[model samples]
Target chain A: MREAIILPTLSDTMETGRLVQWLKQVGDSVKKGDVLAEVETDKAVMDVEAFHDGYLAGPLSQADSDIPVGTVIGYISDSPEQAHEDQGSIPEKTTVAKGMPVGKTTTKELNQRDTSPVATAKQAVPDTDTSVPVSSQQSGIKASPYARGLARELGIELHQVSTASDGIIHAPQVLSAALAGPVPNLDAGPAYRYKLFTTMHKAVANNMIATLSTPTFRVSARLSFTPLKDLAHEQQQSVTLLLARACALCVQKHPHFNAVYTPRAMAMREQVDVGIAVDIPGGLVTPVLRDAARRPLDELNDDWRILRDKVKRNRLGPDDYQGATFYLSNLGVFEQVTHFDAIVPPGAAAILSLGAEQDGKVEFTLSCDHRVVFGADAARFLATLSQLLDNPKDSLCDAAKDQ
Target chain B: MVEQVYYWQALNRALDIELAADESVIVLGEDVGLFGGSYRVTDGLYAKYGEWRLRDTPISEGSFTGLAVGAAMVGLRPVVELMTINFALLALDPIINMAAKVPFMSGGQFPMPLVVRMPGGVAKQLAAQHSQRLEQTLMNVPGLRIAVPATPQDAYWQLRQAIRSDEPIIILEHELLYFSKGPLEVGLEAPPMHRAQVRREGTDLSIVTYSGMLDVSLRAAEQLTEKGIEAEVIDLRSLRPIDWDTCSASLEKTHRLLVVEEDSRFAGAGAEIAAGLTERCFFNLDAAPQRVAALELPIPFNASLEAASIPRIADIIAAAEKLCSP
Candidate 1:
């Protein structure tokens, strides 16, 4: 049997993944678990593994094209002849480069199995033929691929559909709107451009929206960074690394500060795994430093260096960025930024934001999940962290010696 | 209106109630009389019922089960408690061939009114032999009805119903759910003996499960709800005569089906349900039916491996999400 190689969801935040490159081409015999292609999700570029042993077949989705997760990009068959037979069934013209103008290929032109909106939307992108007006041919409504497919099948204008949730219309919403008589022309009077969200940006937007729903309060502290700066210079460690170390030490003293608040229970983590926010090209990523308080400063620096390289290369695994009890976002490297509060990720109880040093003092803003940490607990944690940063040499060297 | 009780206590209460209500009711199994059975399901029953009714048998499942069948034939309602479902294999011939067929073979002269109670499923590191789930095997038998009760309430009523039924029935219990507590209505009519119950109602998908898998499915449903997917959970109280009506009704509304079972995937109970539902509710389905079952391998002794081997909350959630996905 010929197995369709649907693009698997690489991450929770990934709705669609851009095919970066194909590792195996047509006529290539591939084994299960072999890297078939590299897909760039919002979080990272991941290798899509072959789930079956067969010769790779085409009418494959083009490289550098964004394919919705779960859409069939290609196939793998028992033999090259079988692969050719399968490819013959798939419309060759439907396999167009993403972002290029899609010609007029309706339901008849699509593969019977790939008749989803994701596949339809890829087919619906207007070609560069000037005869058809872009406005009439393309109603750029922010809707899911499945919704778009259903709208096309029903001959319902996407722009006229009313969504109950965020402006993005999903299939269920589209179905409901279609059921409730004729949809009103909601797209009139406004000439707004439909902006496509990158997977990473969408994740960040979703997280920020979710964080707003949580009961949170920010506590800012101005700490004298002269001691930490001097200690960092003497120890040849980065100030951000030193601050993370201090935060880790503070978490050890007050375990509640290193806790996650779910509706079920408050999980107090014994290990002070601190996630340090690193600014990547597209968005921010927090690579975790496991057992940060216990590890020596030099060892922590070594780990940080490796993680920084991985982040730069877009090779950080899920483990590298997930399960941080506490988060640290230091904007101290940028000279102009004075102080800014950081959004605490969903699972973590608190995030520590460090501002640029001015007059030998750095502003530290602690945003906590009020459900897990009370004002007093955050205050106590910040106070301990401040104290630790005030005398970094004595505390860090003493902790290292004790370890 | 109702009081909470542990799963084992509910079984004990049902046995106590049935023994007091009927003179012919008797309990027989290894350690059932003296030590109160392996998981203490028959705890304190020996003292109240005395040695005649609450008689303990030696370590011979086939002989004891055969004796229970014989007792049932001669106008006694015998409830035979096996230490675990793993040991029930020793008496499969008696259970399937004799106890299940005696009524039909004898031309309705004798009805096998017997209830075989046994705990099954992986608990801690019971290893391969001890952690077997043979509900699928027992369910395949023609005359034997299978009941897997997940909660204290179901355990209480279903056991009584099984004991009352003239047909031979197997009560498959989870050893891990022995201590879990739920409400048991004191004076209410027992639920139907051959129907499934919708534990949690939703519209996005139906998670059909029973036994300990019901808990896992409910937890998975809760997790799915957090992601905007409402999953209806169906607990198959009766496994043999599957309540296809309840399942089909839920599938008609949800249009998606995910069968979860702790038994191994191939030809397991979930496969049977999936196959049956696919046949009946083919037009109602929006997606192909998916199943989350224990991997097709022996349950390992290691804690982590054992945990990995069985269908878990995360596995159910993943399977349901895939089934619901467009």
Candidate 2:
């Protein structure tokens, strides 16, 4: 028996994985669970284990190429002699092409049959006329009689119906077309190849797109940043951490801001784990600070330092970055970003966007999910935040001392 | 009013009632008098109606079934009990040539009222010869009608209806269904013996089956319902001159059709159904009509192989799924 080793998906965002190297040479006898090769996925390098005990064979894909997720990488044959006989000649995954008759008239068996009309009819027909006239009509669409009548009743042309995965148009395919309103043909405009995206890039894209279904309204106020900035400079702390801490405290005052909108009911979280957006090369990440509302300042500083180092090295696992009840995005470092607003992800009630300090004030924009918090609640949240920023010295020092 | 009864007991009760009501009603077959019939369908009838009305004949099927036909020619309603349809092959000459053609040849002078009741289809380990279904053969005879009842209620209703009709009819029973139980309302009005019955109503696809396959198709319909495919189960109670109006009406509602039969697929009863319906309801079908029938081989003697050789519940479900799938 021979088994094909196909590339497997190693990460949620991995459309393609780059082959690192193969540990086994051609014709090497291997056992099940042996590491055959290493695959580089969207986030990390993972081992591909042998699923069956066999001799490794090639006509294999060369290492360092990004192959599609389900493409065949190599093969394992039953015997060593069979493995090395036809090197570099055997093909990859085989498929019955669409629209081909699935059972291509078993002529060899039909000829061996004692009686066959097909065998008898073969002697009477001429050989030159080869095209099957049945499939040639209606632009070569293969459909059933009832599906044709349904398309006529629905006022849809036969050629316009989308063929199902089996390459035949049926009632279900026609019904789905009736429900699909005005589909666009974007492939006619663009020429492109599938790209292997990093996990961080996928995270940002999906989270942003997911917020489109949420109804959001932004509230902006000019809050003084000098109080928080001076505290950061004097205590050797990060301004973003101090800002997240102050936002967590304000969330503690107004519990509605700590809630997320769910289909069943509002999920009011008990503790606020604030997420601070950080920029890295080629992508972005948000490493959460757990219990930011109750933790001490020095401990928060140490956790933030480690998270920053992990982000720089691209080592943030899902546990370190997921489940943040509130978010803070700072474009203050750019110093030229006049104003901006960040989208509130599904799990968070709101995200606060901060711009560069102009004079002594910073424009803070709060984007809230209206389903969880209304306009008046957001106004009160901003009022409390402005008060905390106006008195950051007492708020941060007294809160840290109490903890 | 209504009571639960086994399929064979219902046929026995119908026979007893018919014999008591008509002075011309007489029954004769091998073991039907002293042995109380092979499947107990004639149990206690010989003692109740006496030896004159119920006569046990010799083992020669062709001669005895011929004797019943000759008796019917003299204005008697003869219900001939053949042990099984496998043996009915020996009597086809008398059944097809005389019983079917005599009334037609006489042209309003003679009316033939004959009922041939026998159990057919794959029973546990009956093997090849004993388990053959020959409804298609009898259906081909021009002046004949065939009723295949699948339940006790239907067996009771259709057997009584078949005895009362003036035409020659064949009651094709399944060997496996003799002991199966259902409610029999004896006084319930009967539909025409040739009419089809919808055992279960659905909208996804129409399953036309008869005899032993009706229960199989109904079980398959239950499984298909859990898979979100609502299958309509139509029991084709009669085979000859099939109730095309009922089946076509079901096809108009559910444009997909699946025909299940215990006979072999090639040129079997299902072949006639799929072709005849495709011709009549061609514009109404959304998919090519499909069939679930016995494999084109002799019924196997081994237990599992015997079960696998004919249309099982799973086979019917899979065929219905494919017909309903895109």
Candidate 3:
């Protein structure tokens, strides 16, 4: 018995994933919970796990190939013989038996059935089962015209396609049914294939395009982060975490920078949820540190560490990155980067960008939505942020003094 | 201003208004006059109009129904109430052959301005014979116009429209909906009988239904919404002179149609609707037209079996999910 391993949805927004590489080759033993392959979704590259113990089956989707969510990329079988027999077999339309090959029907049988297209064509018409060949009509097969057309084009028999209710074969049902069968080697010829945007990529693209529509302005200033860097090192914290804490403290004093500007009105949020921009393999993601101004420095550091780990693992839930009143993008860690401004992420009024430290000073750029914070307000917020960073011993530890 | 009323009260109010306005209108059926109708749809009509106008006849659907057709042959507008639509089989000869055909056979010289009000649907364990839905049987007749109202507003306005029209009409009401409450806009003009209302708008698929199935379909639509599939629900208020335009417009957008009905699957209302939609919108349809109808068996007397026989909310959701699944 062989089972088709489908590409599962990793995220709420993920529609399709690119099979980056297969961890196991055909005839390899697979155990439950073992990572079978690496799939690149919209947000990040994730592992495709084997849900059942079986041997890896061949005719797998080629690496670097994109498949829709819920598509069977490959098959897993109980034994090597079954795995080999299941290789290149089309997936069943209905739910397949666990660890069992969909059916014993081979691609050769489908080809033989496909040669008689006229017999299947007669079955496509409504209320005329007699028009079909006596044997085919006796079987009482039901399939949509589009499904029949695709089955004929693919040289697959309509009977091989599984249906859920009413036994009517649809085009998608036919396509998936065909996938379980011998997959054509189309990737061999095309050196360069178009990769469809993952859901996260599409969302980022759309957000960036929408951000371009907002009336935004940038203000740059040099900050002496020597004290903050020392304090962060003493606290066993990264400079980005300290910067986020400083922004949270600064946002409490300068509420305008923590407000979101919409077409209707500017909303000033009560909590200073600062979003820390982190670069992953494919793109950038901002995992939010909620209520940074209210939480203790130690707790904030712990949360930031956990968030980073989650982003690396692509396990950030909706709450992990959503709802940020302010954003922080620090490119200071990168040796080549000096100073760069980031487009304000949606829902945030402003984003603070920090460049690499040159000497005892680092250039900070604040991009503000002009509707929410004017040039003067942005300057004041940046100045407050600079003051907090310059004296982290007072601001960073002040919140914990009350405790 | 909108006023909330029970489904039967709306029909009662429509009857009260029509009986007060017209002197030539008469009400006749078993338990209709003295009993204020088995469902109380004609509750106060008998007291207000008296025995002359509201005449209670024997339990003979065939004889009383034929008498209404004879009354319509002259100038009187007769409103015949059948206690349940299941018993309408006894009156089918007069309804289909005479009342429905009189105006056409008379070459428009005489118009059969008759309204047959009956409640049809599965209610508890009403047994096989009593709980049958026979609107599909009447829909097959060409000369008659059918109006099946799912809401109180439709019940109020559609019944009034049926009484006013100079043609024979059958207003099918759900047995369960008689007591269900909904807002009825008092003075609002009735929508055209041929246009089906899009009760809920969605982009994925259209769940075309009427009568009690409208409520069932709406519940199914809610479940579909939770599954991230937005299903558009079209309530076919008028079954005969079937609302093709509204159905086609919805199908043009959704490209998938799931006709749901409480009738049996074979030669049922949904089958006709599904076939009709396929014929009109073959190129627009992305998938084959599907129907969620009652199982092809007598509605059982057992509560669980009866519930299983008819199209339930889960069955409708399953059908919609399959149609929109890709």
Candidate 4:
């Protein structure tokens, strides 16, 4: 017995998932609850786990390509021999059984039925038998006039164009099929291959474009970071964690800084949740610390430790990284970054960027959505933050608690 | 410059304007001079223009319509009124043989400045006899022209345009649209009477309809917007000389076509639209052209069945959604 493995929907708005890599090879033994591969969604990389205990089968969908949701990525078979079937059939052929479901027509019979795509399409007409299935979901494929023309021009076969559109192929499906263009007849130019963009890269680009409508202004100042650095070293705590905790405290003191501007009214947030940016393999993510201002220092450190571990393994989910009242991005490790400005993400009033320490001072640039907070409010917020950073013994008490 | 008026009032205003302007223009039909026409389209013209210009005759469609055909053959421009299109069936002989072919058979010697006005489509419980839409019969004739105006503004513009033109024109008005009100700017410039108008612009599909089906198609297009299907509504104001250019241009962008009609499905107006567009826009289409028309059976006398027999707003929406579902 064999069960098909389909791509699962990871988010509310997700339409497709990119397969990053497969953890198990064909013919390899696999058990239930085992992660068979890693698939990347718009937000993060997620695990595609096996629900059935069997050997991973062949004809697995390739990696580094986006597959629509509910697509058959691979199969799990009960025997190794079944799992080792050659990868000759494309994904579309597997969707249709090639011939009419009449006493199991063989590949040789299907081959003899047609020498051209037009001929094969005509062969879908039922024979003189009375037992043909009533409305076999895919007994026939009907391509629109425009789609057929597109396929002909692009040198793609109609059967190879797969769509979720009942039994018809429209122009959109044909255009997507043409996405993998044939080798360019660049008869005079050098050979080059096109690589599609990953979901994470596209998500980041779209997120940046969304913030372009917000009116923003940046305020910069050199803050004393040596005291916080010494406090972190002496107490054995992460600098980024302490930074996130300090930003959360500052946000709590300046409630106006936590408000996001909306058309109806300015929304003042209740709890202080700080999102700290972390670099991942292909892109970056901002894992959030929920209730950072109200939670105890030891709990905050433990949450930060878990978030750091997830970032290391690239397994951040939406709950772990979304809807923060304030944001902290620390580039102090990249000593070359100094006095850089960041855009204020939607749903947040401001983002604070920290640069590497030079002459015992660190550059802190606060980028704010001007609709929520003014220049004076930003200046006051910065003054409060600098005062806390200068006197770390009084401010770093809970953040320095044992993790 | 724009005033809201009922469809019947728009027709009355057009007739009043033309009668006061031209002495050669005369009206002859039953009850038009004394009773002011069935749907009140010729209201008050009896008192203003008197019986000579707005003359009412007995209930003899064949003889009266043939009399207008002869009057148009000479110098006078005749505009004949049949209370409903069902009665026009008795006058098809003079309409098909005389009014449509005289100018051509005479080598352009006699200009057929004739306009025949009638109300059509199912209305209330008019039953099957009175509620007939035999446009396919009139449209099959070559020299004849059909103008199906949906709104009061178009009703005003097209009736005047049909009266001034030399060709034989049939102004087929819907029985239900007589009281339907729309803005009428009598002074505003009008497009060529036969040019199809795009009521709404969309990219998903094109809905080609005329007369009674125009308003229904527009409402269906509005509802389809909420379902994520943007449908373009094209009012084929003139059916015989269908403006294929406008429909073909829409198909160039949308790639899908849906024809809506109040007539039957077999060889009706929608059939010609789908077949004609298929021939011209075969490569541009993204799906087979579809139609939303009345059932092939005779329209039932029951009210609910009568309503169900023809294409409603919901029917057009469902057909459009299916075409663009891909």
Candidate 5:
């Protein structure tokens, strides 16, 4: 009878333990209580004692993989030859030991069955496998298409081009590999393309593109903020804060503007999670201020401060970036942007973009989703905002008196 | 209303009530069950709950702590008390990794409501081991709720809240404050978990501290008051899910800031508070935030040296004065 080593508790508290060093290797005879490996726990390193006496058969997980606990790290059997044969050189065999309990699968099972000897052989013996499949398209490594093109252009062997992401060749890898050669060609290739956005920017770009593609309408209005500026000067507060207060109040009244769009079922959400687009060095980022309609001006200011700092540091996590029913991107700081069309972020039904205050009046743009909002709703929203901003002194008083 | 009680008594009462209310609540530690705990906080607990709930384990903090982790996973709420935080080193695994990261790593599938209580900070001449204060260590550990109750009301409410929360919570009680008396109105209701409680209100400077240093902060506030310098004292009872709202509000009011902690000044919990405040309340600040903390050295056994090792009220007052100075 052969016994398989399955991870005892898949979701154990100590899921990933660092393998200090594997004491036993393939073909090594192990007895009960024999030292198999050392695992570093949170506190200290402890010896992992083997519970069964068997020959070690391993395509064992390497160190630093943060392997999920209860996943079979290796296999052990009574006979060395049988275990070796049963494992079929570690890469080709995919026969999961049967008769194990439900939810119990050995290391053999985790390996996907690849009847193609060439695939398994490639993993098992890199040199021999690469020599046989020089002309084959599949490199088994993941690299970008540009990288593969550059490699081919440079006459670099596909197997020698080690950098592949999920079998796709990435451009950077190919560029680096090309650089390693003597008198390497540095000029751009026909297949090469420049990246338009960084990782974070790409996410923002995708969402913005999706938003622009959606049915949307624009409404512009100029409100006299001469009173608001005077009020801010008297109250010793910023005009930006005054605008934020008015926006919050408007959100409370025209709750429909504070909504999310659902494309799957063609519905708009009711909850108001307001997103404030803070202009950082890398363009803009909108950190959502949850429940903005309910929170006071002071509270909103507090949230704004946190979000602004987060944007500056580029340390905004998913909680800060995700979820915004509506967006408020103010470009009033720039003297040139008196009025400009604003792009609505995905999930938000509308975005209120405030422009620079000029000639005793502040230009404002209200961008809304035509699928959910209308001209009448935009009019009400603008009216409320204008009222609040015009009497900025009242907004200051309300904030100061907030409990 | 269950009668109002002091923080120490309230904490003890909460333990009693919770243990009585649920069979899953079990207390385990050295000198906890039979000896009634070092501070006698567990006094009469063993007699009432019997050996099951108030079971005592060997001095093996590591293995027994691992046992508690297993017990918690198997539908039991174990309150593992370390006689002093110095001994927590022996159980750092179960506390830091298993108990804290389990819920988060499991993707909310399993939330271990385990509470680890320990007396941290310097009191007498207990030397380096016994007098070590690592509030910052717990603060640095993610996925765990760190509670440092400054007052009696917090003492009781935090423990109760920790029990109710679906996460790991560390209750760091200052050794010097086990018997300190303070007005505590308990039994009516409890405040929100992780919310910072304002101990005193002022407009000039904000004194932020937690656990044992809270006493010194309050005393410093009183001293500053006599000098005509109003200082607001905020007790950050919950370290993890920090009450940023309360701290931000106070900072907005009092531009000058000072943080006091029993931990060392170098990379202490005060650093995080100061850095966070600096980011959120940058424009509102007048003077850079100052931290009054223990000198960067191992706590000594000498009474005078130990006293000097931990932050004193005088240090806090001086820091506040310096911050307020034009």
Candidate 6:
């Protein structure tokens, strides 16, 4: 049986991938797990491997043509003979140029894919050429060679343009209407505009937009401690990590402060995964520590450093950044900052804003969802947090102390 | 001890002094010959220091400018004359690509001890083709030092200091000032090349300029003083590696700046100075920095039109008056 192979959602962030270079051509036999073609995603060039064994078929979108994701990049069959028969369906002129197809594909286009069996089958199955002409003209539009060539060059649809008075498509009209100018000649170089955005930027945008939905209330106060500076030197860990440990221990005592609130369910959670807001080059990222209330101080130090480095390199996958119960945004590095309020991230109930260190004292602001956690509960959490910070070693276990 | 000379002649004296003081120095360019260069900056040097040391070449500005880089790479200090900076358009490949970049790119294995001199800025009715002020254009490239000296004393001292440094330096001179006479002081003295000089001290406001406009700015400051304005004049002798410390220090005292230039107002070197001042002394500023510059229209060929094309002393005085107003 001929099995249709459609594009699968690769990473949680990927929208579409370009068919860079097809390793297997029409009529070539493929097997399960065989690398069929290379696809270029925004982040990196990746290999698209086959899920089922089959003979490759044609009328396959030409190698360089950009099609929507799940639009039958290629097909697989139960037998090599069937794959050979499928080759007749693809356009003869469709072949990869250089190494890959050159075009941009964003993630928003990939989200529109319909995963139903019927839609996938219709996309993957190749249609017979005997039913209709393979050229762009069979759709009932007569365009001259020059007009057709100009349309392809500009990436314009010939169907959208009217026929010229001389019964031939005018290049100037096509260019003026489609490109907003006289059509650039085929010999002219392709016009390109560059846009630069890293994976870290996309992640930051998503988190900020998600965070705005929560009705966050900011509560600020100054927490004085002379021992923190000396303890930080003794442990060789940043004051930020020590503060995180203090918050984690405090969350364990007052679970309401650490819990997440769901508006739909009208419920609060019990687990604590503290989101430590690390400032990356492009923007900020909050990588969470699972069960931070249970982890030792030294473990938190090691984990925070590793996560911050991952954020800078844009190597943090979705799992590394997700599942936060609360966040800690420390601005103690910038001396001018007295206090600042931050938005609470979605799926998290609260965020704690840490201000600049002044006169050997640390100022903090705890902003939370008032619907789930009360003002008194927040005060109790801060008191417990202060106590843990006073002697962090007493709060952390022996094994964690070694990290 | 008290002789006087043209600003360009003083520049040649400084070059000769540096070449004699250092064995690594050599001169390269078109018509910098026994005929002595188009502006005669290197007049008699060809006979004293033979063909190899004082080399004259074909009109290929790009290739010969590249040759200066190649020569500098092998421990030779080359001073390349672009004849007129209008011709520098041909030599940007070497000036920006090789001469400026070779040091950082090669990880400090070699130092580019090269000085490129070009008689720049609009000169009277030399027409649009011959007259152009692009010191600002050269200032945009990183790893290059730009020096635009106004006085003969600066012409001598800055030229001497530029030859001693390990970096590539582009010394821009106004073409009309080659014949202008000034007092000559030929010692190993004066301020560092990157520092701006306060030509005249006053309390009311500051008028900033460099190169040809420095004279105009000083004249403007003098005219404003009679009207009881007391405008302080600052000559921004160095553009790149800008003397921000001096400008900011002045702004702290004066609270206003009227930058005058022969270049067009849009994206001029004055903009960079204004931006730097804003960054360093934003709160100290009483009024926005005012710029007196050439009109956006092309440099016209007629004498009256050419005069209108550049910022005059009247323009500088008017701008300073506006800045000083309450």
Instruction: Specify the highest-TM-score model's number.
Output: 2
Docking class of 2: acceptable
- Name the runs in model 2 displaced over 4 angstroms: A1-183, A186-222, A246-344, A347-372, A393-403, B18-28, B51-78, B93-114, B139-145, B164-168, B185-210, B214-260, B272-292, B302-305, B311-326
Residue pairs with clashing backbones, model 6: A15-A107, A20-A100, A54-A77, A55-A83, A58-A90, A59-A89, A59-A90
How good is model 3 by TM-score? Answer: 0.59
lDDT for each candidate structure:
0.83, 0.84, 0.83, 0.84, 0.73, 0.74
In the range A190-226, model 2's lDDT, one tens digit per residue, is 3222244666688687777678889999999899999
Best by DockQ: 4
lDDT of 1 at A116: 20
Q: Which is better, 2 or 6, measured by DockQ?
A: 2
lDDT of 3 at B62: 97
Docking class of 5: incorrect
Real A-B contacts recovered, model 5: 0.00
Each prediction's total of clashing residue pairs, residues at least 3 apart in sequence or on different chains, is: 0, 1, 12, 0, 14, 7
The residue ranges of model 3 lying beyond 4 angstroms of the native Cα positions read: A1-190, A193-215, A221-255, A258-338, A345-364, A378-403, B1-71, B74-91, B115-126, B149-164, B171-209, B212-235, B243-260, B273-290, B312-326
Instruction: Report the alpha-carbon TM-score of model 1 versus the true structure.
Output: 0.50
- How do the residues A301-358 of candidate 1 rate in per-residue lDDT, one tens digit apiece? 8998899899989998989998888999988889999999988898788999988999
Q: Which ten residues in a row have the lowest lDDT in candidate 3 chain A?
A: A116-125
lDDT of 6 at B206: 77
> Which CAPRI level is candidate 3?
incorrect
Judged by DockQ cut-offs, is candidate 6 incorrect, acceptable, medium or high? incorrect
As for DockQ, the candidate ahead, 2 or 3, is 2
Candidate 2 global TM-score: 0.68
lDDT, residue B291, model 3: 88
- Mark the 10 consecutive residues where model 1 chain A has the least summed lDDT: A115-124
Can you tell me which runs of candidate 6 are displaced by over 4 Å?
A1-403
Tens digits of per-residue lDDT, candidate 6, A285-334, equal 77777767666665676788888778777787777778877778888789
Candidate 3 per-residue lDDT, tens place, B1-326, comes to 99899999999999899999999888999988888998888898888999989999999999999999999889999999999998999999999999989889889999999999898889989999999998889999999999999999999999889988999999998899999999999898889975799999999999899999998899889988999999999999999988899999998788789999999889988888999999998756768889899988888999999999999999998888888775
**How far off is residue B181 in model 1, in Å?**
1.0
